[model samples]
Target: MPRSRLVFWLFFAPVLLWLLLLIVLPHLDLLTMSFRGENDYGEMGWTLQNYRNFFTEPVYWLTFVRTALYALITTFITFLLAMPVAFYISKLARSRVRGALMILLLLPFWVSELVRVYGWMILLRESGVLNFVMLKLGLIDKPVEMLYNDAAMIMGLVYTSMLFMIVPLVSVMESLDDSLIEAAHDLGAGKIAIWRTIILPHCKPGITSGAIVVFMLALGNYLTPNLMGGKNSLWFTEQIYNQFIASFNWNQGSAFGFLLLALSSLIIWAGLKLTGQRLGEVAS
Candidate 1:
């Protein structure tokens, strides 16, 4: 064998093995499990009941739709919040300030996601820090219930997903030429026009990539929605968890998992199509 071919295999083999073992195999197992169910004789056989249940059951389908909608909303909100920060860090900030700001963005992630969600709980709970401060400042008559709601869940999702959006945006935006914006401004283009004509067009790939990632994370998230939204979360992942753990129905869980995977893939495809970007372009 050639030396280059040997080196290629040496590098590629581990990645190929990792994907096969960790991703491809597990998904295949789940796919098989999703099709297994009891027949009239009470023997497990190939069946579509698991997938059918998702559509026939109102709770199941409704939760799935709700989760997708929330994920989309979370992605859009994260994009809006990340864009300005990415612009500042990439285009405007000095080296020292940029580094400091990046560190701040990354600092939360150094802690486990569970810890960060609990931190939000500490701030948002009725007897937590925010209410105490508000009471002290005479801002409210009593401690307001802030935790365990849709708004709280959305906030937690956005908080966790922000860094994902910002990193991609900043990465792509850094490559944008400042001279383009300068030339546009020099030609009497407004700030909005500069952003519309230059910055946004330049950042389409990053935006699409970030949005896809954020949507997937938010859609599949269990901890933040479960903890922050409490009993009222109603997230599809919670349903999947219930099916697997709480109900001890692995087949149902597998079906739900595949449904989620399908939904993520479909949305990502649609987003790329809408933005006139390909998966390869976004990934690059």
Candidate 2:
């Protein structure tokens, strides 16, 4: 082989091996496990029983649907909150201020995600800092039970996922031409009209990228929902975890894992179709 070809192979071989060893092979094993089933005597073999259980079990399918909906809600809320912040950092702030804001945004990410979730637990629990502050300010008569609830779970999801949304939005929005906004203003276009016609259209790729990421993360999250929402969370990932660890049913866990993979793929495909974006463009 030529030197260039040999060099190419040298660099690509590790990546190819990593993908096969870490991703493709494990997924193939899981795919097999998902389709297989065990007899009453505990003998495992090929069957569709695992998949069927997901549909037949109200606890399983209902939690799946609830998790999907919550994930969607988290993605939307993250986008709404991140958009303004990204806009300030990328478009409105001075260079020094932008740097400072970016540092602030990045600070939380330096810590482990598990630690961040625990921090939220400390702040949102009934006797936590937030309730103490509220009591001190005389805003409430007593400490509110803020933890182990849907609101707390959602807040944790949004807090953890917001940076994913903000980074992409800032990347796209920063590239937007300031001249276009000035021109629109000169033409007497209203702020909302300018935003609708100019800003959003230009940022569709970023929006799609960010939403896909945040949605997938929220959907697959177990720790935040489990720790913050307690037993009532019932997130599908928690179900998968229980099946694999607590119940020692790898087949069911594998099936649920594949279902989540399918869900993410379907949602992403639908979003790309609705937005008229090609996968290649979004990937780039």
Q: How many clashes does each candidate structure show, in the order listed?
A: 0, 0
Model 1 lDDT-worst window of ten: 1-10
Candidates in order, TM-scores: namely 0.94, 0.94
Candidate 1 stretches with Cα past 4 Å from truth are: 4-13
lDDT tens digits, residues 100-211, model 2?
9998999997889899999988898899999999999999998898999998899999999899899889999999999999999999999999989999999999999899
Worst 10 residues of 2 by lDDT: 1-10
The sequence of per-residue lDDT tens digits that candidate 1 reaches over residues 1-284 is 45688899999999999999999999999999999988899999999999999999999999999999999999999999999999999999998999999999999977899999999999999999999999999999999999999999999999998898999999999999889999999999999999999999999889989998899899989999999986856999999999999999999999999999999999999999899888887777
The TM-score of candidate 1 is: 0.94
lDDT (CA) per prediction: 0.93, 0.92
lDDT of 2 at 146: 91
